[model samples]
Target: MAQFPPVPDTLNYIFCNTPADFHNAVWVLRHHPYLILDCEGHDLGRAGGCVTLVCVGTPLAEHIFLFDVISPHLSRYDIDALLNLFNDRNILKVVWDGRMDYLELWSTYGVSLENVLDLQVAEVVSRGVVRGEGEIQRMKRLQQSYISTQVSDRLGARLDGLHAVIGLQRCWKECGFPAGNGKDPAVVKMHKSIGSRMWVERPLTEQLLQYAAKDILLIGILYAQFSKQGWIPRLPSDYYYLLGQCQRYVSAHREQGKSAAVDAFKPCQIMPLDVLDHPVGPKYRCNACHRYLSLATYETVQGVAPRQASTSEVPRITTLRRPRCRLCQILALRAGFRMDQTYLVT
Candidate 1:
């Protein structure tokens, strides 16, 4: 029921905590072909964590609605209507790194998001991972010449290996979005100072709420940009493939409990389908990614052991093994997961 002054940006936002506001929000949201989505909370996507605010922005950042889930202002019927909107297959939902948001929504409120396009996934897929030294150099030069210098640094570092996930803030900057308070260094510092605790605080600071709104606004802009640049897939098969990756990303941590560390290694995001499903050859199933990939996808490693089975009491000595694919190995290594290796087969 509390209303704050409009954020100093073009988008208009409403804090929808009361039942009447929620009703109007759902009605307006249903008319859009796609909605920009993001969520804010304290340690969300983990057990004991909660989603405090769900930011939904209309296309082109016209209007943003802050659905306050922390407040018990809406009835079950109102909640169900919003849930239906999320689950609707006809309507698209644009997001940036929506894994945690998806987990929190489903785990906390039983709301499963469908028909989603994650821009983070799109960004990674746009520049498919390459391994050869010549290819890496060529790609780096190409990106630097076409995109901004910062983007070259942002993306070039991972050309020889798996893709590193880009944060939404940097992603916004990389896309050449207009400068505003949202991208201000001082505001970013203030957000870091507040950290995860601010979302749980009742009557959140107007600045913090505005910060949340601006995130979805950027997401909308990124969606439009990616679409216009043909970064998003247009073909039916390619589009569905991207969508499947987005779904896989959200489901990766479904069984994981609350932990202090965010899992930086998502197989789908690290090595997208575009990178994995090519150069058709004899296939072997990877123990980690669980995909039947070509032999080139793997690296020969010696003295590597598979995860030990709990039921067996006898110790199984580590042996030369090639359990996971190359991309999975890179992901595990970057995430500080322990691995034993010999060398790349090729």
Candidate 2:
């Protein structure tokens, strides 16, 4: 069996359900400058689905509180106190992929998560950064690890795909953490088998609770490691750029109908915006993805037009363009169906 990242046994995990428990949890949680956050639910962030668990871990994974918002014993006030932490800019909420969590929080409780740092975005952005290693060598290793050479031979083709979002488990392994007892294969296998029911099923088993705790633990550890290596963006401009990206991710789901699923895996889904923000040729809207993408994202052909003829008597040059971005084009080829090109221009 493959090794799993070790979670320390000494990790303090509290399942807060009753009023007193929630009150105590909130008091302790608010004291932290930053908290690692994760959520589990049945079809969470979607119509007909609801958030079942909210996991918050202190820095260094000292104490992890599993807040049971669905518990009848906990009043709205207790839940609100905990959610106030989400709105507090003074307390940072470090998350892996927080899109659904943000959307569900707003749609269900009217809370807008503030001071968020999405680690998934940080990981994608880190591919472009080289700390101690030589730039060329570091990029090569990153490409080998995270990107598919078949995608494109272009340098850093990995940056172009929203599919590059790395899951927390893979991120944990990549960070070089050792296998621990909490990562026992049986426990993991059981958790996956539970699927959506894992969160909604009352009286969550110890194995499931530990699984939830592991997520926040991983988030906290990743933030610490990324911070030490300077992977998390800290400059005012870069910071806001990331914040905007996180907000955009959440907003993508806001207007979505209850049954409508946000297809995160679609090639046309948004990638980190900064990667495509380069100053280059004017962007053209992809007929498939409907996103304004740079020239590099499409297939181009040169053509001569009599109307565009230059004053020097050269035929006016024009480029025949493809209807879709390269990524979406490939997807259409494999999927054997094309999405409607109709989209309102923003």
Counted clashes in each candidate structure: 1, 4
Candidate 2 matches the true fold with a TM-score of: 0.70
Angstrom error at residue 59, model 2: 1.8
Across 1-346, the per-residue lDDT of candidate 1 in tens digits comes to 1112233554458999888888899899998888998998987766567888989988976889999876777787777777788889899999888878888878877778888888887877676432233556555544443333453454333334444566676666666653443354665786678768778888987777778888886777678778776788789998898888777655545544333445443333343322423436556666655656566556543443444577655544442335766656655655667654543222
* Candidate number achieving the greatest lDDT relative to the actual structure: 2
The 10-residue segment with the lowest total lDDT in model 2: 265-274
